[model samples]
Target: MSAPNIPSSAQRGKPSAIPGSSPAPVPGPNRSGNTKTSAPHQEQSTAQSPQLISVQTPTGGGAIQGIGEKFAAQPATGTATLTIPISATEARPGGTPSLALGYSSGSGNAPFGIGWSLNIGSITRRVSKGRPQYQPRSEGTFARIERVTHQDGPGNVHWRVTSRDNALSAYGRNSSSRIHFASKGNKNIFSWLLCETYDVSGNAISFVYKSEDDQGIDLNAVNERNHAILRGSVGSYFSRALPPLDFDYIAAATGERIARSVVKEVDWESLENLPEGVTGPLYQWLDLHEEGLEAVFAVQGGSWFYKRNQSAAGTVSSLENSTLSRTVTLEPTKVVNRMPNVSDTEKPRFGQWDVFPPFELWPSGIDIGNPNVRFIDLTGDGRADILITEDQILTYHVSLGYSGYGAPRSVHKRTDEERGPRVLFSDVDESVYFTNLSGDGTSDLCRVRNGENCYWPNLGCGRFGVKVTMNGSPYFDRPEAFTQKRVLMTDINGSGATDIIYVRSEGVTLHFNNSGNGWAKVEHLPSYFLPPIDTLASITATNLMGNGTNCLVWSSSAASDTCSPLKYINFNNGIKPHLHVKITNNIGKETNLSYLPSTTFYLRDELEGKHS
Candidate 1:
């Protein structure tokens, strides 16, 4: 046979394999009979070194071809490239190999009898046969190869194998080749096989074959089931795996299972009852139901207590029969006011005082500036209670109850001590008296007839007069007394016991009973600057500064420019002795003055040396 020669064009550029033709097997005798051949022919084996299969066929006047090999002799270890070439004829001396069957002409056909070349690049080998391998490539190989197939005569097939792998692994042997060709093992099962088997909707997955039929399967239900399984199998794994779900969402998704579980685990009865119109989690119900529970409490207390109907207004007669009772009654009586009485010689003595009036006072009767007293249930019992004060006495009568005043009783004979039958008065001149001094709790009765004439007038001119204790009764020893004067009871030293502040015309004295005996004098200010003996002076102790023990005396004298109307005197331990006085004119204008201890006395021109 004549040796094949390369054409001039073939010499300029590499020629591709002929379409519908395979490379000629090495020309030698077949060695399949287990016999040794010549030295040059010994290298060829009948097994063909697992030769790669390639096929090509003509379709629509064009060729279809496939070019592949058994990867490398070994598994592809790393990245490799593959290249293939195709042509209608092989360029050589005399004649080139050509396909001349019923080939249709097309625009896609290559010139010079239709040559084609493909390049595959960067093939990486993954786990296969538990070994690292790679695909091979030829020089100037493209990044990818598109396969085309062709058919030959009598259903015959042919292929043109690529030289890319051979070129790229030129220095390597069969097993060590750096380049390889595509193979069945290179396909990823997960990406190609399993992934193709499923249809995707958002994040959910369904069988591709059954996707249409299972379109209505609730994904939420599947998620809940998955969550339950995962939460159970992995010890609360779903709690960590999934985003936290709201309680209501969980309950709705799980269809009462979550609620039942929570109910079974939680103490429902111990929790407060939920309010009306409230739903969902117990905590939400509790929060929403608080006002409803409070309303329930109010309703249970009484229908009349919080009722607003006119029938429920006025007099709630139903309440009287019920636990609720009226708290006050009124009666008509003659009013009187008696002055201090004279002694046997008809001289006005300090001891023999007259019986004050049993005034028919209104329930709201009191001076404008004085504290008011009203008939109220001090002990919370449903009964009428009596409260008496200097300006008013309230006598509650549930028996003859009315919204206004009740029935009156006949005038009964008064006790000798009372001088005649009369309404109880808080400012009785006698030893025993009752008043709501601090405006808290019930009215307290104070008696002052236990000590001796330790009430000497020279000790201090009693502006409101003094009452000597007649008997040594401990209950009456302290003589809880209140004049029209302002008295303050406080424990300045922080002891549990209380001390008394007695403000009189002469001075301000603090009587602290350190041992609960007679009043021991702790502080005695000879006098607080005032207009005169009686100028409607009002004294109050207030802690103006934030310090715990510093007390300031707020006092007001006669409301005139000549009379200092307001004063702030500091009575703390460390502050310099000074008095801040504010005077007001007849028209209610004011002036302020700061008086230190060094301030000299001011002589009044009208009073003649009596310091003002």
Candidate 2:
């Protein structure tokens, strides 16, 4: 036969068959059954030998592609490498989750594709160069959104978010918009905003979206209660900035350093009229000034109150912690002289100083402006309350149940008195009187009294004014003289009608309400019915054992004693109740509101300034 034209290791002048001393010289026959190794293929023990790995199968060219180690002679060890990848959203195999190797023996000892129980759950490594990352085998890669935050406030809200990815060269941009009214956490779940306008801040590899929208619509109840409409506003005011989420997107474009810039007073406005169909809370402004005096008014819950400033001057602004020292005296500076739009419904029927919530007078030393103070329940809580007004500001004070007054508080603030529409009378001295003087079920208030007035000096606006009403309609024509001092009221006789106690030029006169329109100054009682009272505190009607009928209990600074003390007296029949006539049975001793202090142990607070 002619010489076969087939290519072989010998024909190509290359060592094949696993290339290591010719496979340790496998036995071969010399054209016979017996075999012998070729001389040139014998293994040699030399220090110059090269390290070689004998793969089970010999490969042609690419069977073992990129490894470039030339073998001169067989040595001891070998080295080879295999690789795989994992992508985002992709996970490794469940059962073995491990990487390993495998082997096989076949043609001339080449590696069997890197044996691996390695099931190598396919990982999507970046298919292109430059921007490489591990992703889900399904789509190869994905983008990231980070540094998201939503700040909620009473007025408006703000949001911040960023879209990013490992591949700076990715073709698409990231985006999302959402509105947040409350707090929410981030997990697999995320939220979005509405009515939002976005302003892009950074690049796509890490594009940031900062958005804002008004939440006034959410605080409808607050606005209405405050008597103002919180319409959509142009800007927002934040107390502080929301902290960043991703620690990477810093200046390095990582998540960490992405900070939210701080913003300040975008000054908000409350429109008086709300758009139609939009229902809001009950917003109403009430005039709380006393009958003829300049007063400050404020609404607390369901009641109206006034702030008692030192000078009884004009109001200025509202306060944060009304309980604090509310005595911000206007220093006599031209405080805004705004007054009450005193609707017939808002004037003070200034109840009896005792029946009203009372506050301690600015005592001898503490001067908080107007040392002259009076008591009346502006909020109708049955306590002797005080309404203090100054600089157009109003405050409310209720008894603290501890024989003292609570911290006068003003919830809201108003700066300029000029902004409001009413005018206050700085000089009128006629005190107010609220009572059911007539047998009628409805009560009336004679806040301002004037019937052809002349006497009472105009200490303030000095305007001689008159006309009083209760619950709106005019009740009666009270003479200016009747209001010179507070008018006391009670059912004097067994008659269930409300009567009036007037102190006139003549001693004290008792005007008995006929329960209708006429007033009869009854002189039928004992020769001396009225007593000499110094400074009366409170007056309560109760049944005293003396008269065997309902009577009145009262406390006052004793004529001979500076220490205010309590006393009791009854009227005619035990049939009905009226205020007590204290001067009758008392000549000396009575327990006071405060406990007497002992010089033996600790000194009493009342014992500080004066002795009675």
| Top candidate by lDDT | 2
TM-scores of all models?
0.21, 0.22
Segments of candidate 2 deviating more than 4 angstroms:
1-375, 380-384, 391-393, 398-428, 433-467, 470-487, 493-498, 504-508, 513-571, 577-612
Q: Residue by residue across 1-612, what tens digits does model 1's lDDT show? A: 121233322224433433234544454556585544321222444554433334333233322212211111112322111222223222222122221211111111111211111221123334322223334355464423322222322112111223433211111111111222112233121111111001121121111211211111111111101112224343343422222211110001112221122101111121132111111111111111111111111112122111100100112234233221111111111122223321112213222334433323323432323322334333333333333332222333222222333332222222332222132334345333332221222233334333421221111000111222222222222345535343554433322233355566566555443322245434555453432334444454433222222232332223342222323343433122112133222222333332111111111121243432
lDDT tens digits, residues 1-612, model 2?
121232323234444433244445456776777777643453555544555544343333322111111112112222112222211222222211122322211111111221111222111213122123334245323433223233542223223322242222211112222322221232111232221212232212122224323211111110001223368668877764322111111011011111111111100121111111011222221122221222223343455333321211212233221121112121111122333331112213332122233334322332334523335444333444554444444454654433455656542223422222122223365444434543422233333343211111111111111221222222222454354443456555534445554444333344455443345533322214333433343333432221212234333334442321333343442222222111111212121111110210111121242333
Evaluated at residue 277, the lDDT of candidate 2 is 9
lDDT measured at residue 74 in model 1 versus the true structure, 0 to 100: 15
The models' CA-based lDDT, in order, is 0.26, 0.29
